[model samples]
Target: MIGYLVLALLGLFVVAFYAGHRRAVASVEGDVARLHSRPSQHGLYLALLSCVPALLLLVLWSLVTPAIEASIVRARFAAEVAEMSLPQVQAFIRDARAIAFGGIAGFPDETKEAAAALFGTLHGWSVRIAVVLSLALAAAGYLYGIARIAPAFRARHMVERTVRGFLILCSVVAILTTIGIVLSLIFESLRFFQQVPIYKFLFGTHWSPQSAFTGAGAEEGAVNTDIFGAVPLFAGTLLITVIAMLVAAPVGLMSAIYLSDYASRRVRAVAKPMLEILAGIPTVVYGFFAALTVAPFFRRSGEALGLDVASESALAAGVVMGIMIIPFVSSLSDDVINAVPQSLRDGSAGLGATKSETIRKVVLPAALPGIVSALLLAVSRAIGETMIVVMAAGLAANLTINPVEAVTTVTVQIVTLLVGDQEFDSAKTLAAFALGLVLFCATLALNIIALRVVKKYREQYE
Candidate 1:
């Protein structure tokens, strides 16, 4: 019914737009210059008036009708509802709605049949009233808007004002969403810190939350907070990120320089897109490749060299993660390099500098800030990656930096901690939120540093 109502509102909007447009043209005797707004603006004004109010009405009616039906049905079946617990009563209402709307219902009885019948009747009347009232409101809005349209009507002003208000609303939503996330993280981490001290979580060496309880059948809040140390996870994250940067930074930057400065136009066009396709591939696919292919190859090579390597090691995951974020660095660095002014290159050439010298001395210095920003963003991407680490790097929170050692990252630990059915109030579960808070702070700091570098160097070049 709501879908049909929406389609009806759409048709009314089309009719209202045409009517308003023709009426405006007739009022001006087809002389567009005599009107304060364009004919399209008048049409849009009428369309918004005819459709927006009806859409809002439909949304409001849809939201409230189910609750209204439930309330009235519960009142009609008070005796039946009074015998059931809250969950059972809620289930009974769900079953009644399902039967009324044509679905299999659990625990159907005579009382439920009567309730379903009553709900169906009420729902029918509610939908009908909603449709009639919505159409009436849309018709009234069409009339009011059409009546107001004239040679001197400020339709464009009103439309622009409405659009500006919508943009402001979107901005406010984004800001509020960020604040909500930060507050949730802070609140949850504080709960975790209440059980585990902040000093232990930040500076302790062990990272075993599974053994948090001292013994069997321990009471709540009796956790061995010393095992909640995060140093190993922090070390593993830094190790993988460093390895990924070693792979990504130089390769990505060199490719970007080649594409921006040295490659022919045809080669650039083909190669850049092909390189960026890596970014579009799912991270899960890269995880599978790392786990199934790269890890084994590394193990075999280590064996041939008479060295022991873990089957699941940081090297495989870090290398694959680097390959994944290559596009982030290459695409951004290419754009930054290309954005260096052509005049700088031209002046360098006039001074008898070769292309290499010009790129090294002039273009690189100009684009240095943007390149650094791109690299820092890639580092953040590397830090946040969970799939590759989970697949290729085993979930052992070892404090070793050896590339061939099996280690876990903060994101991977967060996933491990939250995977099963567990008590949210326990330090084990709440530890995920603390890890998340730490990860958030790290990435936020990287972004802030990137912005600072961009600002500091941008002035010298500009």
Candidate 2:
């Protein structure tokens, strides 16, 4: 039944779109032999008119239906429980509501009877109300659009303006969503800082989030232990990121250089996409390989060399993350290198510089900004990566510099912080937001620096 209604709404929209287009073309053709805009634009204009309002209605209805049904059920229960004392009635009502929603399995017999009746009525009314209103709105929009189509109608211009508005709206929505995310992080971090002083949280050397968990009868003046020191986690993140950069930058840059500067058409064709296939592999698969394959090998090798290696080592995770980011760095670097004028390379060759020297002195310097941007992008990916770090890097949050000794990262901390049963207001959970804010700021700063470098280099060449 729902599917049929949706199909009917769609069919009405299609009809309205065709009607608006035909009217637009007819009006324009009568005024002049050639229309100001193409007939396709007229069709698109009508399609937008036909669909926009009805789609908006459908979206609005979907969002509100559940809330409306819940309210109706709650209200019904409130009325039914009026005879009982306030506290007992409230408790009974809460349990009854939970039972009705399948949250709890059993309820008092009287409460159950009342709840079932109320829920049935609420569900039936809400569904009928939503379907009727949605269809009516869609039909109304179609008819209104048909009525407006006439000989003097400027449907082409109207449609173009509507399309422009839609594009602007989409862009605004994206920007607003980003702003909302940052604001949410800021607010949550503020709550976290209220419990753990911001200064201590940021610069503390130990990262035992368990310190935030207080036990019964814990002394107030005694060291309010739950080591919130974030230094080791940050260090682990930086160390792994550096390792990834070391692995990815040289390899990705070399590949980009070959593709952009040296590779023949055949070589480029065969190799570029093949390298991209690395990016397509799921990070979870990389996580498995890190945990199951690489870490054990590193452990055995370290033992042979008379060194201790943690089973879940940062090196294994970092290497795999680097492999994951190689395509992003190589592909972007290749495009930017290719975009550099051919004349510059030719001039270096004319000066009798060897190809390698020319590449190092001329091409690389010219593409430095773009290369920096690619590296920064890779760094951002490394820092934000969660799955590989969580699976391979032990969650102990050790405050150590030794890569072979298992250390955690900010992302890993965030995962463990909120993964299990957690209260939203607890210091442990809120710490995730604080870490997120710092990570966001760090990545944002790197991106800004990369952009500045790219801009400066572009100016130098121009």
Best by lDDT: 1
Show the lowest summed lDDT stretch of 10 residues, model 2: 216-225
- List the pairs of residues colliding in candidate 2: 206-229, 211-226
Please report, as a residue range, the 10-residue window in candidate 1 with the lowest summed lDDT.
214-223
Off by over 4 Å in 2: 1-3, 23-37, 79-113, 214-226, 460-462
Instruction: Return the lDDT, model 2, position 157.
Output: 87
Per-model CA lDDT versus the true structure: 0.93, 0.80
Task: Report the C-alpha lDDT of model 1 over 1-462, residue by residue, as the tens digit.
Answer: 868989989998898889888988999999999999998889889999988888989889989999999999999899878989998989999999999999999989998899999999999999899999998999899989999999999999988887898899999999999999999999999999998999999999999899889744556558887798999999999999999999999899999999999999999989999999999999999999999999999999999999899999999999999999999999989988987889999999999999999999999988999999999999999999999999999999999989999999999999999997988899999999999999999999999999898777667667
In model 2, state the lDDT of residue 246.
Answer: 83
- Model 2 lDDT, full chain set: 0.80
